[model samples]
Target: MTVMTDRPHMTTEEFEDLARIAAQQAEGLRLEFIGGVLRSKAMPDGDHGRVILWLTRICMQHHPDFWLHPGQGIKAEQYREGRAIPDGVLAHEDAFVGQGDWVDPGPILMAVEVTSWDSDTERRDRIERPRAYAQTGIPVYLLIDRLKCQVLVHSDPDGNGYETVRTVPFGKEVKLPDPVGITLHTEPLKDWVR
Candidate 1:
């Protein structure tokens, strides 16, 4: 929480280096490249991690065609434009399965910041990142904002963005039938132990 430098953004290479260093050092921190910036986010709680895990698992059951890749420091491209890491992402075999990389062939689905307190950048991810991903012709963008304990689903991809299909909260029945057919009972998300 005590950084001396005023870093608004850094290149993909710099971000990768920092990420590697953070992993190697036992500083016990979490990080990601958000808004072209290198940031060390606060420690995530049980709720944050489990929600993503559950989302990845159940989503795959609903749509076996797409693979829900783990948030394992893999590089993702924004329609062959910008590069950043996602909390959780989906890789489709038809388009980008055996390709160069997400940045090279592009990923058709991605998730942005879902567990942070930086309000400004968080909103930017919910707003800007989705727009960028949609422009890449990606079909879905899910913003997991626990701030209000809600999962905002955007689909029906248009130019440079997706429509706000619905905001599913705890105890709500959520549905996404376009790129995938998933009806999730999200009350467990609100009960996040983290």
Candidate 2:
């Protein structure tokens, strides 16, 4: 069921179709088309899920205008026709009209990814995903690297990548910039996988 290839060369519609079919069959697995390639990963472990829950809770309590979505697909037109399924996403409350699965990157306020157990997954989360998000002009990209026990916030996308990057350790609070102005409490994020 792995869809990782050198050049998938799938159209946006084709990618979406594949993702829809995959979602119907697999419950915890996420299939995404990123950077002209199809990629798949299983659901996150306990710590990763906890981190996302905490962030979602905080956003719900503090930010009334924003909506927090866990495990959703985001379509970024700039990245050679691929959809990205980030670990968590924060967007305007009215970003989507109805009960649909896919969302465009234009209305996205932030995209978040928690580092996975696999090294290849970690590499894609740390490197390729951010570039793809930036190319789509996503305002902010957050990486929760449990392996490094640090959180990295990237903003001000310059087409190719983000220009401003701020990294902080687990116990520190990293401030998200305007529009999504809030501080993320990273102290409770335990590296469950070692």
Candidate 3:
């Protein structure tokens, strides 16, 4: 059995390095630095993965210029001194370079998060993350809440959080504004099991 130890009060850079090393050691695990803390989570489950797949397909079919990356870590230098790993990220083809593992939030067009089983996870996805993304000036933030069966589209960042917030139920379609400019069919999301 592997032993796990907690390193308290680590700086952002230290946390990021630890996360990178941990990810390399455990291939399937995803580790992120959030608010100076190292947060680790398992790879997404079936339903979560399905939503990401559908989002990728939709983006490819409608907005070919944008690149949809699933399970990628985005670094927000201006926000909370941490890196966030969103469920899905939509950005321009040339937004990221080949050098680093983390993508800067500046080039990211939209960041997507799917709510998980834990309440802490849900709170982070719904509240904390949106604030972080907005502070980083990422244009849009999309949240898929499986527990609530709804999708929230957040835009108009104001450093602290979004100024505009729109919500749509699972069956309804959510029209992504301007740069993205496409309607997302959220029907398939309704079929999410737990």
**Which tens-of-lDDT digit does each residue in 78-117 have in candidate 1?**
5243455566677664544454323442544544346556
Structural similarity to truth (TM-score) of each candidate? 0.70, 0.88, 0.89
lDDT of each: 0.62, 0.81, 0.79
lDDT rank, highest first?
2, 3, 1
Candidate 3 lowest-lDDT run of ten: 2-11
Q: List the residue pairs that clash in candidate 3.
A: none
Number of the top lDDT candidate:
2
**Candidate that scores best on TM-score:** 3
Q: State the lDDT of candidate 3 residue by residue for 11-79, as single tens digits.
A: 777877777778789888787766555667656788888888888888888878788887778886364
Q: Between prediction 2 and prediction 3, which has the larger TM-score?
A: 3
- Backbone clashes under 3 angstroms, per model: 3, 0, 0
- Candidate 3 TM-score versus the reference: 0.89
lDDT (C-alpha) at residue 172 in model 3: 97
| Per-model RMSD to reference | 4.7, 3.0, 4.2
Full ranking by TM-score: 3, 2, 1
TM-score of 2: 0.88
Candidate 3 lDDT score at position 105: 73
